[model samples]
Target: MTTLLSVQDLAVARGLRTLEGVSFALAEGQAIILRGPNGLGKTTLLRTLAGLQPVAAGQVVHEPSALAYAGHADGLKSALSVTENLRFWAGVFGRTEVGPAIERMNLSNLAARPAHMLSAGQKRRLGLARLLVTGRKVWLLDEPTVSLDTQSVALFAGVLRDHLGAGGAALIATHIDLGLPEGRILDLTPFRADPARKAPRGDGPVGFNEAFA
Candidate 1:
């Protein structure tokens, strides 16, 4: 399979602490589930991979336009309707259609409704749907199943399966079983930075955030 993303000896920073000695490669048609306890820097690692934050060490190799990130925030426009929101993202990705994405997320009935009126789960689904319109081969998702119900989670699994089938890849940070038997798990516990060791200057602090500590 074609390699979609490559990370070598990567170190990700979250505030003062850093997650070091991390490395992984994601290939087309594959899925990797990030596993670790809370405060293990999973979010920081994903943010680093997604280019939302700077890497403290190592490298991430991939096409600039190949990545699509979905974090805790839905990244939505509350004033915009579901269809309008998708259209906006599609346009941003140089696409003009949102029909398929809407249908795939089972948001057809709610397409015309304003985003602010949707439930938490609905918003999460919509956020995930944005991935479809991106046309990006590598998806970097952080807790994608946060507010999804069982059925919605199943629906998302189907969509993900389809994406992989079409040569797309996903690196997801999640705790729940996404029903993907083929998906591999990468535990981050082993990569946690030592609290006593001091990271290099400008590389942030040496220990995890107090909230996680």
Candidate 2:
């Protein structure tokens, strides 16, 4: 299969701390689960790959416009209804249709409800649904199952399977098993940056680590 994303000796920073020597390639139809204990920089790495943050070192190679990222935030407009939110994102990506995405995410029932009225899990589902209208080939998901119950988790897994089956790729940072039989795991423990190496001071404001701290 064709490689959709390639990471070469990537070193991602969370404030002054860095996680280095990480490398991986995600091919079409493949899903790679990012595994490591808390504070291991899984989210940091995903953010760097998503271009939300600057990379500390090394390279991430992919075609422009190939990536779609979903983090903890739903990235929704509170005033918009579920369908309207999807429609907005679809329009951003130059897509004209969102009916399939609504149906796929099981959001059809809640389509007319404003985002502010949805519960946490419902909001999370709405967040994940944005990925469908992106039309991007590679997905970078961080803790995608948060707040989702057993049934919704299964629902997400099925949608993920369909994405992979249809020639897409994903790099997910998640704790729970997504029940993907073909999924591969990349443990970040071995790739942790050397604590002894002095982290370069940043000239700008403190980054993700300090904010969370």
lDDT tens string, model 1, 85-125?
99988888898888999999999999999999999999999
Per-residue lDDT of model 2, residues 84-171, tens digit only: 9999889988897899999998999999999999999999899899999999999899999999999999999999999999999999
CA-lDDT, candidates in order: 0.85, 0.87
lDDT of 2 at 202: 58
Question: Which candidate's TM-score is highest?
Answer: 2
lDDT of 1: 0.85
**Where does the lowest 10-residue lDDT sum fall in candidate 1?**
204-213
